[model samples]
Target: MSQRSEAGSDAKPGNRLTVVIAQLDFLVGDIPGNARDILEAARSAERVHGADVVVFPELCLTGYPPEDLLLRPSLDLRIQEALDQLMAAELDAAIVIGLPLREKGLLYNGAAVIDKGRITARYFKQFPPNYQVFDEKRYFAEGTEPCVVDIRGVPVGLTVCEDIWSDGPIESAVAAGAKLILNLNASPYDIGKQARRKALLERKAQANGISIVYANLVGGQDELIFDGGSLVVDQYGQVAMEAPQFSEGLYAVDFTHERHCQPVSQPLPEEPSLPHNIYSALVLGVRDYVNKNGFKSVVLGLSGGIDSALTLAIAVDALGADRVRAVMMPFRYTADMSREDASTQAKTMGVQYEVYSIEPMYDAFMQTLAEPFAGTEPDTTEENLQARIRGVILMALSNKFGAMVLTTGNKSEMAVGYSTLYGDMAGGFDALKDVPKTLVFELARYRNEISPVIPDRVISRPPSAELAPGQEDKDSLPDYAVLDQILNLYVERDYSAEAIIAEGYERADVERVTRLVDVNEYKRRQAPLGIRITERGFGKDRRYPITNGWKIGK
Candidate 1:
């Protein structure tokens, strides 16, 4: 075990134990960079706060779910090398960091405690969550034992993300005489998850009679966004320190070990307003997805509708107005109000705006398809042609300017197949892909509450794609309130058609919406990646085969 040059001795009687939880954002696969970040945080904690030990989020080295990269021999070697380099640093405080470990041909999600240039103890993750976005069981072998170590004469227990979700880890640590429990995590964000986490941690602390420190990772990884709400609770289930959500920072707490550590009062930052919290989450999601993948700018089609308006607001907030560009594509059926709303919003947001009429392109397509369309009436076909033309133009801009196109369709439209396939769906990212239409209106109202960025007409007017003359969203799909309710049950809550009908929904409506959702799996498969705020999002969490024969009533 690693031993540090004694900084003298343990805490004196009635002395306080200083602990810091480093809520950091780590880029996946960036081992050297992450290691440097870990070291920097450790140094800061030791020098600035005089902390006895510092803890970081789970999988801080390789980032969370290094996915298949954990299987690569070279990556594993690099992780070990990074840990060695971290151990080589001379620091007074013991540091606990998370990484993956491969032992005897079995991989485990592990955390290591380092002090005086040596690893004192290593704890492998006991639970590998396999449901939803987690697939740890596919790659990791569950650890059977808990790790307990000494820091300045205080017995400390170590557990990875999933270990603390149950009673075993905490029970084992308390049974082993641990006075404090440090839980490392890479927990992803879902609406209302923060409250759930706090309740669980409080219960664990109260039950075990030990002060518990919880640290979680922050930032967007692919479709998953982690809101770092790292926190600390004392033996009596009182919160001592709480970090802000959706940002990276270090939070410190002082624990005095007597017969038990009584909770100390510390002024914590106020919880962010709901709109601010959700908006920040969306912005972070977009920024990380673009910057991490090396994109310079973003492009999106701006209809005179609320969906596109809100999407533009999010893009400008994420990538800055200078980095965002909007295109106005007016079709034959487009209204003058839409044109005005689109232009006004663009100018208001200070983004580069351009006008591109798809009439010329529509004429060209009609001429090309005239022979095959012999005697057929141009109905939805002509409307769809306009959408495709706009899509092609936006994609061209994306290619020429090196900007990714952002799609603006919401969950309600997506569920009812009200959106065009290659038209509105063609983009590198979808900002509102998981957000429903009702929530879209709520967000627009919330944005306006902050400042009058979106035009009043944009929020007040009925939503329409203007694909056909006098087209409104309700022309094909049901009203958003009803649609969203049906979808929340059918899609988000995973209710069957019969179950939805039993909940007072008309049988026909339930069947129509559910069938549309099932049929549109192909479209969702082709859609761009988006942030996941709900329990089950379209990306990795809800996996349905594209070509499947399963029917609801059959």
Candidate 2:
């Protein structure tokens, strides 16, 4: 439900400010459309909610992380046209919206305050974060000035994303006589990003004796998913207004400065469980990737393993039963239990299910290569053939039906080069790309709690590729619990082999796993793009050369 606290609801006999938190989903590179949305929302906030000011997210004009689109020759024209649209809108409520402001030679990440059909004030982003999933320094120069504008007799400060992440912007705003700071954010979500943001904002508010209004972008843009958990922290570090995560809408809060900064609002909702939050991120990432990319449906090879089962469930939840298709390909080594579980889960989820046997295809390939393999013993070539056969079939269907194929490889398998390239890794997108194997089981159980869609056996049984007879993941891999820890430290934390070994891990296991990760760069490079749920994912966060000679030191 939308919470609203109109001006004077609990304020003294003085003018109160109604600020609208426009937590909205915007498409990247849609300059004109974003401006239209801004103007439209501003109009409603003024007409319906009696809002004195409406605050939008960071980079709402060109969308967050416009990337190289900001370099387009026509970018200036588009942004100027958008500003003109807002001026033409004649919105009564002053709107604070984010956009790119190009000066003489350098471009800046900026926000503009529009009121009375004119841009009154502007604030540039002082910190252009260049770390993981952020390369703002590549495109934008750092801003140095603080902008504090008067919004109906209230001194309000403005800062873009990453500005408040540092200390200077907020402190400057306060020093410039800002009683409240409006920080625009396009901050993407990871596992525990919300908690860190709340803590940081609370401390900033409490220490500086200033109220903070944070508005974050919502929706998925490529691998990143922005959870729309917009919030307002009062001067005393009290959370006066809290918005729900993963949903987009306009939220309102009434701030009165008669005596001191005080915001009145209803009780906020609690944060979701960890698994629940991860599940929602994947779902939003999948939904937006499919819808935004113009895919009608998605298809995936639903092996009975937990990874594929979890991927299938996520696809169903993201795009719905009608938009998801599951294909079970049986080989000679494919167990009866595997086929049964795959079928049962698809039936429970109400997705279109099909079965195809790759024995004939495998036999034909083997027969063609019989002469060359006359003296050689059976090896990974045969095992990879089975996986490649399935890939060919899925790709054939995708080509014929226009359904995008979703790969089901998880982070654990991708990290160790355990998957076959162009085989299981062949797909347009991966739902579990950043998820580890152990977390895959946790999410499967979490989904069942919502409603039993995945089979219990699928979650309880041992994971296998079902390539050779009696094959299980542990046959060639360390235990998932141990391997995931090593992978996390090495891949996400960038810990060296010696550093990981010092963490009480077996030295041999650490060396072996780190070597696999290093050698598997080629595989990960060719893999499909997936949802990013962790602080470091293979897609945008971690970048390594296909050929390198760096070694870990003791």
Candidate 3:
């Protein structure tokens, strides 16, 4: 790696600049720690890589989406302290970092360029996105100007996360005589988002005829996962260099000012399959949420279903098999095949496994409620009772051993309120809360391809809660193949029932599924927060009044 320090000197020669992209992770609201990390990375960039400039991701100091933390009275004071610490270091390389800047009683999502121990330039984010998972408009006053600075005798422009999404920011920088653009991002991942980002940057770079360097943050924060696929796009819009997604490192791109700023090309990293990307996102999300929240390990109820089987594989991958525990709570309705598959996978994965029948607990609960349900026939109450008993058992183990319980419900079930309130929904984290049923099967197959950890029967068998005799998911809901398409249209695309029907889905299926989603807001509201992978998840991504009287039709 020391050879990299001489990269600039060996390049085309006249006035070469090496800018290192600091694709790193920082915990939200940890101002002091984040500042320390920034200084450490900058020092390494200068000492090891001989970098002329080190650019960090957006909001690296306070971390991205600080949310209501930005509203605290002491935010400005803490930010100032962090900046003072950075400026005092006086490192040799110019460092570009992000934070919330308070000026004249207004807060801005801003970036500061520090050169040789002093503040040289600052740029506030011009566009503060408010849709989907972003709420920047609630806290920031958008900057009205562009910032271009000189580094190593080359003109460089600065832009924050949302600025490049629109046309104005990059164009303004080009008009301001910037030969190269540096974009600091805390961009989250969705399906095929990386391709979209590269295409967008390619068009922007070609249209402006200016090279662009993108530095993105990596890691998981609550429900959000920022995949750092930092790269350099040349003036002609060709991807010159790229760092792999879901990784953290300092990637250097060399540039020489011959006629125009030209980035030295490097071999591009191979793009992973979509299943691989989604699987990696889930692993990172679960690991960070569990570890960041200070849990030692995780426990989940494995009911021999695809949802739990996939979740078990993910947990083991994220935290290792030693840190994961699987419990099987079987009732009278549970099949021998279901029990056999659960045990086989648990043993194969080498995780701690246990079985405790819910018959006694269910009997106890039913007897206690016999008088209250005097004349009521056996219905969902009995089934729900079985689920709640299993939930209580899992929660007890979690409480006793200090392991967080992982809920195993997928997005498809979450959409229609198929999950019990305190039953299967009782847990600290859910790994599949954003994954639909169809995608769940795809991931299960993908995981098996890597290594056969999950039992084949688990994937081949029909999914059931085993709360009632001979019951399956299809007994109450439509086929997953049709249901997931309806969900994607209605939940993600915001299509109305009529609009979904126009997409060729049956009107009865559309109306029933849409109504279930509408009325089940209360259930989802109480469910545990999970990793978000789709464009619209049931977390901060979607908000609706649970008591609204709005109709289902357009």
Name the regions of candidate 3 deviating beyond 4 angstroms.
1-13
Per lDDT, what order, best first? 3, 2, 1
Clashes of each: 0, 0, 0
Superposed Cα deviation of residue 265, candidate 3 (Å): 1.0
RMSD of each: 2.3, 3.9, 3.9
lDDT value, residue 315 of candidate 1 = 92
Candidates in order have lDDT scores of 0.85, 0.89, 0.90
lDDT of 1 by residue, 192-257 (tens): 888889898889898888888999999999888999989888887878888889888877788887
Judge candidate 1 against the unseen true structure and give its global Cα lDDT, from 0 to 1: 0.85
| Model 2 lDDT tens row, 1-554 | 11111121232247688889999999899887888888888877877788888999999999987999988999999999889988888677889999999767889999888877888887778899999999999899888888888777777889987987788888888887778899999999999999998998899899898899999999999889999899999988888888988888889988878756567766989778999999999999999999989999999999888888999989998989999999999999998988999999999999999999999999999999999999999989999999999999999999999999999999999999999988999999998999999999899999999999888998998888999999998988899999999999998888888899899999988988888988999999999999998999997899888887888544
Name the candidate, 1 or 3, with the larger lDDT value. Answer: 3
Report the poorest 10 consecutive residues by lDDT, candidate 1. Answer: 1-10
Candidate 2, clashing residue pairs? none
Candidate 3, residues 82-197: lDDT per residue as tens digits? 99999999788889898888778888998888886777788888899999999998999989888888776777888998899897888888787788999999999988889999
Please give the distance, in angstroms, between residue 54's alpha carbon in candidate 2 and its true position after superposition.
1.0
TM-score on alpha carbons, each prediction: 0.96, 0.96, 0.97
Name the TM-score of candidate 2: 0.96
Clashing pairs in 3: none
